[model samples]
Each structure stands twice: as C-alpha cells, then as structure tokens.
Target: MRRLIIFALFALASIMAPIANAQWQEAYNNSGAFNGFHFTDSLNGWFSHIGSQKIIHTSDGGNTFDVQLNVALPFNMYDVYMEDNLNGWACGTNTGSGPGYIYRTTNGGADWIQQTHPASQSHWIQIEQVGSSIWFIGSQSVTPNNLLIMKTSDNGSTWDLTSYSQFDASWLFIFDSLNFIVYADEGLLALTTDGGNSWISTTLPSDYQVQRVSFKDNNLGYALVANIWSN
Candidate 1:
C-alpha cells in the first residue's frame, strides 16, 4: 500500500507539471518600462515604453531588440500595434495639457509620422487594428475622467467618437469592426455589436473591479475580476 500511494502521488505530479510550466515567462528584459506590446507573429514584435518616445522592435522572436523612432521628450509612447512588419501605429500623450498623439510607421518603424485626427486632441490610451478599421480608446482630457472610443476607417484621416459617461472604462477588446467589449473598474461591462452605435451594459454581482475581458467567440467570453465573492 505504501508503494501504491507513492506511485499515485508521482503520477499526479507528472500530470500537473505541464500546467504549472505553461504560465508566462520572461522573454526579454530591458531598462525602460514597457506599457504595451504586440506581435504580428513569433518572429516580429514591438513594445512601447511609458516614459520614452521610442519603441523597441524584435525581428528574431525577441532574441534581439532594436530601438526605432526616437521622438522628443514629454511625448510618452503608451501602446503599439503592428498590422504587419511595415505598417504600425503608436499612441500616447504629449505631457501637460496637450492632446494625445498617434504616430504611424509605414517602412517598419524607420520613419514614424504623427497622424492627424480630431481625437488626437484628447488623451488616447490604447490603439487597436480591426481589419481595415482602426480604433482608438481614450479619454477627452489628460485627467481621463471621460471615456471615449474613436474609430477611423480611412486610417486616421477621419474619426467618429463615442463617449461613455456612466462608467469609467479601463480596457477594451475589439472582436471586429462592429463587435467589441469594454470593461470598467466598477463591475461595468459594455458590449457593442453594431459598431459603437449602440451598447448593452451589464453589471456583475458584487463590487468586484473588472480588470480585463476576452472572448473566444461572439457567444463565449470571460472576465477577470479583482476579487471573488462567496455565496
């Protein structure tokens, strides 16, 4: 019986070892603070720094990184998204009371030009690419009390802004040009299927703050909350 118990324990340990090792591991370490990162594939990826105006790109799957597009100070890079190796966008603020800015790189970050938009006059937080549409999630001011979602189909030449007043959105996930989800700190979850023209709001039980949300499909999704509640 002793031998049987030890064998059972070893089998269970073997079964659980793969699950424990599947968590996130440190791939690369740098001196600057990375606010957001996205990879087009395993070979190409980019990361933006919070305090600096530069972005780091790795071509060989993070084995090496090269700094590109160094703008002046006071313009922090918050989020970066690359549609491909050549076309990419980065969004951030210009310090003080200045509006947020979006920079685009066509030749793989060799040159980044600030794209002009009406929403660029606000504090942008995140940028996402959905098909041919580009979405910008941010606030109207630097303090970021008012949440806004701006979409541009013509690649930042024109923008349509959708403002939310009830809940302060923390993060957003775009499923497509028409469907997306936005979650807030106070258990607020909003869904939009007809683009940002309409939104359905749902509140989860308890005061659990929502951190992030993801959907496997249009019907199945999950939300990450800060705390768990008991019955």
Candidate 2:
C-alpha cells in the first residue's frame, strides 16, 4: 500500500498524454467494489472483492475474469499475493473477534483452501511473501495490544506466530526475510533483524513520526514522515 502513491504519481504522468499502445480500460462491471489484487505476470492475475466472498481471476490481463473461489466472512480479503499463477495466498480481518483467516491456493485458483495459523482470533490486513516465508501482520482491530506476526517458511504446511504487545500500529515493511520495520507509534519504530525474534526500538524526535519506510538494505532506507501537529 505504501508504494501505491509512487505508482499513482507515475500513472498521472502517463495518463496526461497517453503511452504508445498502453491505455487504461475498464476491467470489471460498475456493480460492487473490488478491494485488492495481485498479478503473477502481465496476463495472469486475480482480484478480491469486498462485500462478498468471491475472488476473480483473469488470464488475459483484465479483459475477462472468471470466478475462482469463495470463502467465509468477514466476506472480503484485505490483500492477495500471487507468487505465480499456481501458488498464492489471501487474507483478511475477521468479524467479531473471530480467528484471523488465511486462504491458500496451490493450483492456480482452481481451488482455495483455508490454512490454519497460530494467532488465535486475530485480524490480518497485510500479507508479504519473502522467499519461502509467508508473513502476516494483524491484530484484534479493537486494539494493538494483541499485535500478531505469523510466518510460514515452508509454504503453508507450518506456521510460526509471535505476538508483540505495546504496539499501536498495524502496517509493517519487510526489507527481507528477516529484516524489516514496524511502526511502534508515539514517535517510534521497531526494527527487527532476526525474523522478528527480537526488536530494537528507535525513538524519533519529539516533532516527527514516520508512517511508512522502505529499505535498500540494513544501513540505508527512506521513510514517509510527518510532523506531530500536521493533519
């Protein structure tokens, strides 16, 4: 989601004059809202809809989409990450304190099966795939007191969940399989280098806070920050 702004700015530039053979076109009906999507390549991709339990897939870019799979509620996926056309995962926040839900498809969305994870009754809003590890970050929605990070290094066969208390944010940026950053609120950010086993907290100045960050490596990165009194 953090990278969306970068894409939007680039889109605006191209849209002003159009690009050779590339143009924006409608891919779906104007009926309901589609929340998130992932594409394995230019021709194969999938999109998940809100307000429903259905997921859509298209092999010809966005020209046509077929109903791929349906799962349980909160009835919408927060994100979908397709490693390829054949293997992928989707996740979302649950309703009314239900267990955080994750769905996996190993056969190109031919079938989507729910996978079990270690966060007992949590809400997952983000899923990132780094190498063989599938990482998820979520909480209870009511509070970040139950912030949970779930990881699976060997596909969906096994999962490792670690919870961190005293955090007030949900978004996380994984620089690699083990090194990443998570917002800790109150002008602080948590940095993890051992696959979230431990954290070294860094406090920002009294007047600034960082909302998002991207890392080129452990020693170099960039952040989107704002003043404490800004809107």
> Which candidate leads the pack in lDDT?
1
In order of appearance, the predictions have TM-scores of 0.79, 0.74
Model 2 lDDT per residue over 76-103, tens place: 5777788878998888765667576788
* lDDT measured at residue 27 in model 2 versus the true structure, 0 to 100: 74
Per-residue error for 223 in candidate 2, Å, reads 3.9
Candidate 1 lDDT by residue in tens digits, 1-231: 111112123345665777985767577675667886999898999988776677889899978889887777687788998889998888887766547888888998888888877754477779887777888888776445677887888767788887776546457888887788877665667888997678898866546666767665777676666654455
Error of 2 at 93 (Å): 2.5
TM-score of 2: 0.74
Location of the lowest summed lDDT over 10 successive residues in candidate 1:
1-10
- Candidate 2 least-lDDT 10 residues: 1-10
Q: List the residue pairs that clash in candidate 1.
A: none
